[model samples]
Target: MHPPDAPGTEPCDWSWETAADPDEVHALLTACDAHQATASGTPAPRRRPETTRWLVESGSVHLLRHTTGPAGMFTLTARPPSGTDESVFPPAEHPLYLSRLAVAPAWLAGGALVGLRCVRQAVETAAGLGGDTLRAQVNPDLRDTCSLLDLLGFTPCGPASADETGRRHAHLHRPLTAPAADRRGD
Candidate 1:
C-alpha cells in the first residue's frame, strides 16, 4: 500500500507505487511533457512510444505515482543506470544520473503545500536510496526552475552546460547530511 496524500486541510489522498512498465512511464512523462509545455512557453516534445517501451524492457527504469486529487499520480520517475544494486537501497547505487522529476500544474495553485511536500519527499527518497547527493540538471530555459530549487535548499555550482545548447541547464544539487566534505565539492 502507498502512503497517505499530503496533509491538506481540504484533504485528498496520494498513493505511491512502482511503475512496472514503460507504457506507464510514458503516461507520467507525457503528463510531464504537458506540464513543461504549460509551465514553459514552448511546446512539449512528442515522446515516441517505441522509445518509451524500449526503456521499460531495459529493466532499470521505474515510476512512482501519487493519486488522490483533481489531478493525481506520482509526477516523479527515475531511470536507474544498468547493473545497479537492487539488494541495496536505491536498488542501483547510481552515483549520478537523471531523474525525471515533474509536478502537474493543476496541483500547483490549489496545492503548493502538497507539491512542496513532494519535493521534500523526493529528497528523502533519494537519501533513503543511499544517494550521497541528489542532482538535477534544471533546464535553465525555464527561468524559475533555479529559484524553485533554491527555495528547496539546492545550489548551483561546478561546470554549467547552457552554452553548448540553446537550452541551458545548470547542475543544481542538494546534499545529504553525512560527511560534510561530500557536500563541499572541490
Candidate 2:
C-alpha cells in the first residue's frame, strides 16, 4: 500500500489477513452505520454478529492503518460463475467480489483518498489473483460509494434491485485486465 500523498500526513500501512477480530469488525461497522445515517438521514440496519463472523471467515480482509490507527477495511472473495445469475453479474467467471468496504468516519470526512486507495487495492488484488473482473453490489442510496466505483472504472451491469429486506442494490463490475489508459490511467 502507498502512503498518503498529502504532505505532513503520517504514512499509512496495509495488512492482508484471512481472519479479522470480530469485535474490531463490529466496531468498524457500527462507525460506518453511524456515518451513513448522518449522511443519508436513514439509519443503516446493523449487521448481525453472525454476519460479521461470516465476513471474517469468508474471504481475505484488508486493513489500512495510519500512524493514528485503523483507517479502513474491505474484504475480497472469489465467487464462482456457476450459481451466480447472469443478469446481475454477466460473465462472472470467478470474479473477485468486493464487500464490507468501510472507511472510518474520521477518514471519510477528510476526503476520498482513503476510499480510493482501498478500491485500488481491491483492483490490484483481483488482478494478482487472476480474476477477470472485480464486482460489487452497492446500496444505491450510498451515493458516495457508487460514485467511487464510477471513478474507479466500474460500470453498472444491471438495474437496481431490492433485496428481501427492501434494501436496494446496484450491481457493478470492472474488468481487471483493462488497459491502464482505459481505466483513465488510475
Candidate 3:
C-alpha cells in the first residue's frame, strides 16, 4: 500500500489480514481501542467482548497493519436496500455499512494520506461486496475521523443524534464509483 504522505523514497509496505480466531480478533480490538483512546485523549467506551467475538464470528473482522505492527482496522456489514428511517439514511439497492474503523496515531503520523488510503480501502471493499453506496455513522466529537470521511467523498446525510451510547453521531454516505461518463472528465 502507498504511504501517501511519506517523504520521497520512503517505503510503505502496509498489509491487510483477516483475523480468523475470536481471541485474536478480541486482542486486536482491545489494542485498537487503547490506541485510539490514548491518541484522541478520550477514553473509548468499552465494548462487550462478546460483541467483538460475534463480529469475528460473522467474518467481518479485518486487520490493517504496517510492517511494524497494527495500524488500523474496520468491519463491514450489508445494509437493507430500503435502509432504515429516511430521517437517518437514504435508500440504496446495494449498500455496505462501515460498522467500525480505527487507525492508530502512529499510522496517522505518516500523514493524512495514510488515513485516506485506509478509508479508500474500505470503500473498495464495499464495492467488491457489490455495494453501490457506502455508509458510516461518525460521532461529531471525533474530528479526525469526520475529516477523513469528508475528504474522501463522503457527505453528511443528516443531523446529529444520540446513538445507543447516547453519544451524538452524524450519518455520512459515499458512492462506491463515479458514473462511467464522469470518469472521462465529462
Candidate 4:
C-alpha cells in the first residue's frame, strides 16, 4: 500500500489488497472485463474460474483501490525463464509476468499516474521476488496501454503472438533494477 501523499505528483490515497475471496475476485474480474468492453467497444475474452484460481494460487492477484473505490487490478506471477524468455532474457534473469491489468474508466480521470502506480507496484513485486525482468504482453488494440508501457521503460520484442484466448499480443520486457525503496531519492 502507498502511504498517503507519497513523493509522487498526486495526493491520492492508494491502497491494495491481495484478492482472497474467490467469488469476490471473480466479480471484480468480471467488472474489469465489462469496463474494458465498454471502453474498446469489443469484449475481451473472459478467464475461467480455474485460470483465476491458478493465478491466485501461484501468484498474487492485487485489487487496487483509491479514496473513491476500487480503481483497478493487476496480477503478478514469477517463474524460471521458459523456452523463448530463456533465450531472449538472460538465463539468470528470472522473469516476472504481469497480466490482467485493468483500470476502470472512471479511474483514468485521475490521470496517467494511476497507471504508473500499477506498473510500479508490479516492478516492485518482481524485484522483491528476485526477478530480473518484468515481462508482459500488450494487446495491440490498446494504444494507450502500449504507450504507457513504452514510457515506463518496457521495450517491445519480436512480433505479435496469439495467446490461448487467441488474442494477438506484442511482447514487452523491462529489466528490473534495485528496489525504489533502496534508492536515495524518496
Candidate 5:
C-alpha cells in the first residue's frame, strides 16, 4: 500500500503495499525501534541486513508507504506468525491478527489519532478478507499505550488471564462491527 500522495504533516496516508514479491509481508518496524528503546531502554531486536528477505519469505506482510511522493518514504507491514495453524484465532472471525504496527517519526504528527485510523483501516481490510476481530497485545507498563488501546475499543482481558509475559502485557481485542468513528471514547 502507498502512503498519502499529498505532501503534508499528516500521517502518511496509511494503506497496504508490497514490492519485489518477497513472499512475506513487510513493514517499517525499525522506526518503532525508538518506541521500543524508550520503553525497554535497550535495542534487543536488532535489524538484520537481510530482514526484508526473511519478512517476505515467512509472513503475509502488508506495507504502508507515504504515497507516491518524496524520498524519505516509510512503510509499515504486518505479517502472520510462524506456525500460525493452531487456530489461535477463528478462521471466519479473526482471520488476521495485528502482528505489528509502526510509523516513522516524521509521520506521527497526528499522534495516536493516526494510529487509531490505521487500526480501523486494517480491521476493515481484514474484514473484507473474512475476519471479524483484530487481536493484539500491548505492554501493560506502557501507560501511554493503555489510553490508546482504550480509545481504540480494546478492553483488558484482566490481569490474571494476561500474565503470560511476566505480567507485563494485557490482551486487547477490537471488533470489526464497531464503527471506526466510534472507536474513540469507548
Candidate 6:
C-alpha cells in the first residue's frame, strides 16, 4: 500500500506487488539507469538479461506508481545481492535486505520524497515480516539516497566496500520497532 503524500507534493498513489513480469522490471530499471548515468556523467552499464530474472526470482520486488505512472521501485530479500560482503552488516535476529531502489528522473525533481517513502515502506514491511533489522548497501555516489537513509535513522554498518563491479557502497542498517506511524506520531 502507498502511504499518503507528504505535506507539499502532488497527490500520488504508491502501490506495490510482487514482481512477476520481467519485462516491466527491466523497463523500469533501464529508465532509472539512464537517468543515473546522465546525472553522474558515467555511461549506464549494460545489464544482462539474467539480472532482471534474478531480481524477480530472488526477492519481493515492489513497484511504486504515482497518478502520473511508475515513479519508483525497490526489492526486499533475505539474501543480499551476489557480491555483497556479509560481514559489513551488524548482527540481528532476522535481517531483511533492501536493494535496487530507483526513482524516475521526473519524480526526483520533487526532492527526496519518493525515496523517503520507499524506505518507510521497506521499514513497515520488514517489521511486519518479523525482521529485526532493515539493511541496505547503497552506492556512495548517490548523495540523495545516502542522505535519505541517514535521515530515516539508518546508520552505517561499517566502512564502505567495493563490489565486483568496482563501485563502492556504504552498508547501512536500522533496527525495527513499531510501525513508522507510531514511532513518528503520524
How does each model score on TM-score? 0.61, 0.80, 0.75, 0.73, 0.57, 0.80
Predicted candidate 6 versus true structure: per-residue lDDT over 1-186, tens digit per residue: 233356544453456667777677778878887887677654565666687787788658777776666777888898877667778777787888988887777777655467777788888888899998998887777777788899998998778866556656788889896556888999
Candidate 5 lDDT: 0.49
Candidate 5's TM-score: 0.57
Q: Sort all candidates by TM-score, best to worst.
A: 2, 6, 3, 4, 1, 5
**Stretches > 4 Å off in candidate 1:** 1-12, 42-51, 54-98, 109-111, 163-165, 180-186
* Candidate 5: Cα lDDT at 75: 25
Backbone clashes, candidate 6: 0
lDDT of 5 by residue, 15-41 (tens): 455434432222345555465556655
lDDT of 2 by residue, 1-186 (tens): 233566665442445445468777778867987897678765476578777777677657777666665777787887522223456766756588887788888778777387888898889888999998898877778898889899999999878876666666677889888665777976
The global Cα lDDT (0 to 1) of model 6 is 0.76
The lDDT of each candidate is 0.53, 0.74, 0.69, 0.69, 0.49, 0.76
Instruction: Return the TM-score for candidate 6, rounded to 2 decimals.
Output: 0.80
Error of 5 at 29 (Å): 0.9
Best of the candidates, lDDT: 6
Local error of candidate 3 at residue 160 (angstroms): 0.7
Candidate 4 vs candidate 6, lDDT winner: 6
Q: Which model is ahead, 1 or 2, in terms of TM-score? A: 2
Number of the candidate with higher TM-score, 5 or 6 = 6
**Per-residue C-alpha lDDT of model 3 across residues 84-154, encoded as one tens digit per residue:** 33456666777788856766555555554555666888888889988888988766777888888998989
Candidate 6 residue spans exceeding 4 A from truth:
1-12, 42-46, 57-59, 163-165, 178-186
Error of 1 at 117 (Å): 3.4
Q: How far is candidate 3 from the true structure (C-alpha RMSD, Å)?
A: 4.4
Better of 1 and 4 by TM-score: 4
**Model 1: pairs clashing at backbone N, Cα or C within 3 Å:** 5-14, 65-74, 66-73, 66-74, 85-91
To one decimal, what is the Cα RMSD in angstroms of model 4 from the true structure?
Answer: 6.1
Candidate 1 residue lDDT tens string, 103-156: 545455343444455566667676777766665666666665556678988776
